[model samples]
Target: MKKQVCIIGGGPAGLLLGHLLTQEGVDCVVLERRTGDYVLGRIRAGVLEQVTVDLMKRLGLDERMKAEGLPHDGFNLADGERLIRIDIKELTGKEVMVYGQTELTRDLMEASAGRGLEVIYGAEDVELHDIDGANPHVTFTKDGSPRRVNCRFIAGCDGFHGPSRQAIPASVGKDFERVYPFGWLGILADVPPCNHELIYANHERGFALASMRSNTRSRYYIDVPLTEKIEDWSDERIWDELAIRLGPEAAAHITRGPSIEKSIAPLRSYVYAPMRHGSLLLCGDSAHIVPPTGAKGLNLAASDVYYAAEALSAFFGKNDADGIAAYSDKALARVWKSERFSWSLTRLMHRFPEDGDFERAMQVAELDYIASSRAAQTSIAENYVGLPV
Candidate 1:
């Protein structure tokens, strides 16, 4: 009998897993709650770690990314007047790529089309059945019709709010979470980027970042109060604040353009233990989530799916469950490492309104240490460029 898998959430995790399974002659179905256009248009992380880029190339998904994506050697850490360059390649011998998650999703979507793989979009009433049994099923409603898909296993890549997380018994899993006091108010402009490398600025006002999406389009963010309203920030206020944080060096290059997209992303670190429950396995944000400070969100999701594909291939093809049983352990090893790295970076850059003198001094010391020590810099460089998967 052929082993079949039902993958929930059609994001990088689900789609990539589907593609990998198909290559191994395993039948798979992907169910997504959102339409293709919405998923492909959603603005998310743009940094691809070295490991993820390598996987894309090995999997034959790098042509489009390489053509359109920008390769960033490093990013700038600005302390108001002085700019420090953290050359990633010099420190880690690896380079990070700036390719939006949406672009990658589009590439995988187009590649998966007409491959005899079922991709159901705009699905509703999504649920998992028989998760503890050998045969797990994904049931959902499509076009007002109820549908049921039975498979040998189920991979949950549905994200933080998806239903797959609920399938695991609460008693068996421990939820760990830390919510930051501030959030990122991100914006995309029609203007070009102010600098060639991403700028991470720390100022008394707050934290600000200047990054790019493409040659002509720019993506920027400002650390703002969690309670701040988007309507309260006008173009003038945003530009003024950005100018102050980015400093005069970048002021000339900063151009005014229509703010096409704007939203606040709450910073948080969350993880759940034991990513598997019998035949059902979880991947991506469905299993863990880290703050975007380290640019590990999308890359980590891709890593989870990559591991899942390998484990499933071994289990079905060679009767090996070692990889499957060790899936959570393997993925979390990197997840927690990223979680700590993101938390450390976030603490160093973002200023808290309620921070005491000790905390502020501690942050300064951390930054100085990272800048002065080769080992500390290497740690940042390795994590920033990404670890081997």
Candidate 2:
């Protein structure tokens, strides 16, 4: 196979990039190590910033999203006593769309064949070669046969565990990471959400989040020590914890149901420098990760793809290389800002085992100040709604 670009990982990032490139008349192929069903089965964040929503709109893929997705003007922050609502629309004049990452990926995936975007699923042992040279190629096994894709550029849209990032020479890449001491024990149920808008609660016990995929599909989470196991947590037990942690007002409306899906996901903030290494550009989790507190994961990936598609389009459509050369610095600037916001929100909303009384007091004071100050609320709202892309 030969193409202008070979995209590793058929997740949302890779598919989105592939579609954008194909729309721009650039030939690209996507390689995925998992089946399409397996990719869509993975539960992920549901919030959509303007950058992500706009990308779908630009690609003519926002029909179902605009029809079915919930648009929220604000979210709540609970400090054990009261909910401090940040009116994101009033503060930043923007709203976030509540749409699952799965649905968004499905939209891209389903449209691929009709749009002539090529995605190869279940590709095994994918590897990159000669990324530092002018010509780069990707190789993998499809079924029992060995296959290779010779392309001008390689896109590493694979997640953190994927091999794309590791293909770069260790001496050429630098990493910054912080792994949280705890993980989020989450439950997805068929009941309605406790509140109309999302809620992030900081309680004496721990941290909890009340969110939803739709009016009928509620998603809830509570922070737990990394040593905790999912099997130990029952649906009733999780509801009980959420009731006490989210405060009585919100809990009054809680609808209990059996969990359709449950799991524990660890939190981490990570970034790899120089998202671009010669002809290989790392996008999404392959280059950066943010704690879920800020809901920046998929949106960050969208922004990276936006920049990448622009760069690649310029290079192929107009024979311009400036965008390609500047992609890393441009993408990293936004990535770091998002990292700071996610880190800050995680610190404010979660109780650390190592935190002392003074630290708790500081958290309380900060919450009190935020509750009383419009400036503080505005800052939070701006970041929550997402900064300009």
Candidate 3:
């Protein structure tokens, strides 16, 4: 019936925040509208920056990740047959870990098991009440009965469509969004990746990405028109498109198989400015979204949770309201930088519908510079490994 912090949504963002707060002896409750199985089944990005990994380590959730997760020092950028490698470790002195979001969530869930952390699943019509007031509370129905939890603060970690963001008065926050004309048609197969590291390609036909989940599981994607349907793409067609977009050199290492899963994800860059509204603090997809091109979707969420948890910790530990008060401004600062990186990378690789000679030439020139200039490469590498969060 009461908690220090009531978290909406049991996705990684909500769960991670709750876990971190609990480590600080903060009392929190996580509510999810879906079953745990449903939560764990959602597949998401696998790349993580050091900041995310460090957070997991701090919460004692990185044992499995450190053991099972793959590490990559750099990734490839391709312009047709030409391969441009950006060595993140060489340029930034850091490396990214390739652990899937699902795996990380599972690790977090397991760590909290039997720790007296209350995570209620299948909560229906979850709603926030009195968020603007000093004593904010959350209400939801479980098993056809209404339940409520009063808290000092409420965290709207539920994703973009959840009710938490809508709880804020429309006049209080501004929304910025950019919907791309295309989507990533992706497939998961039990095949080794074409390369040891990820490969991003800009082809005459479209954009392509060669990535992996593990040594035996490969994830690949190619940009397609928004009108394209997953049903229209067969396993063979997907591989063929990848081959063409990846060029002869990269395609030479192709390994093909029946897809275990396939889908098309629309790309969008969205941010709800001022992540905090009174006692209701927004985190992760509930506050911001970035295109998958930069592999920033999950990492950005991690950073959001990182800032939110730190702010909450400061608030409870030292009775410091400044961290909580400035959370919105501080978080938004990093959010915009990441948005710029994701937007720039998306523009550099994808073929826009209105792209003419100059647009294409600009993309080529930028990619060339990144490949040849150490400064250009370092700029990207630092952003990729993540800036100081």
Candidate 4:
């Protein structure tokens, strides 16, 4: 099969790119290694930066999200029993939309279907060929039958584990990463949110986050050591730990119930440099991953897509290679900034096992500064709400 572009991975990044291309009269095909249902079922962070929300609106995919998603002007940062509210809207005139990644994915899928999207689900062994050359093609199998797609360009929107990034010869690409020492033990339950806005708690025990998907569906997470096993954490134990970490004030608002979903997600910051090599370009998790603490993972991916789409649009329209050539540089500039923000948040909120007295004191001092200084608060609000598209 032939298309203008071949997008590997049907996740939000790929799907969003496909949507933008199709809207511009550029035809593309999306390949996914899993069933549509399986992709939608994967739980992920939901906080949407303005850039993402704007892109979704432009694609006409925001009807459901705008209606159902919660908008928070600010969030609370807890230090012991004290709550420090960071007023994002008040400080920066911006806010973040709280929606489930699952729901957003569903909306994207539905929008794609409505537009007659060409996506192949359950594509196995998907690989890219001749990306460094003028023409690129994708090879994969479906139901034991080999398939191929020849295209003008290839978009690697698959997650970090996907094949697109590896297609770039190690000689031409570099992977920079920092894996955190802890993981978030998260739980989802059908209960009222402990607060309208999220609370990120820094405690002596560890770090905890009180978040939600909707007014009635609560999602919470507490930092746990790598040695901790998921099987050992009963729902009761999770709540108990959350209460202790979140402190007495926030804990009083907790509405407990049976957990519908539970899992541990390791935190990390990873970026594959030069997001593009010849005709192949990486997007989203395919090229970078941010720790979930700053909620930049999906938003960063969307920013990558925007740069890619803009470049591709110019290339296909006026035969301009400048945009394409500058894609990696421009994308990486913002990528690194987000990496710093997420890394800073992770450092600020988590209790490092190796932290010395001075280190702990520094963390406390930084938090205190942000809570007291309007400038420090604005800096965080700007990054949290996102820099710019």
- Top lDDT hit: 2
lDDT of each: 0.86, 0.96, 0.92, 0.92
- TM-score, every prediction: 0.97, 0.99, 0.99, 0.99
Enumerate residue pairs that collide in model 1. Answer: none
Ranking by lDDT: 2, 4, 3, 1
Q: Which candidate is the best by TM-score?
A: 2
Clashing pairs in 4: none
2 versus 4: better lDDT goes to: 2
Better of 1 and 4 by TM-score: 4
lDDT of 1 at 366: 73
Off by over 4 Å in 1: 1-3
Instruction: Output the lDDT of residue 326, model 2.
Output: 98
Give me the displacement of residue 15 in model 3, in angstroms: 0.9
Tens-digit lDDT track for model 3 on 1-389? 98999999898888899998998889999999999999999978899988889999998778889899999999989999789999999988899999999999998787776666789998998889888889998889999999999999999989999999999999999999999999999999999999999999999999999999999999999999999989999999999999999988889999999998999999999999889988999999999989998798888888989999999999999999998989999999999999999999999999999999999999989998888899999999988888788
- What's the C-alpha lDDT at position 229 in model 3? 86
Between candidates 3 and 4, which one is better according to lDDT?
A: 4
Number of clashing pairs per prediction, in order: 0, 0, 0, 0
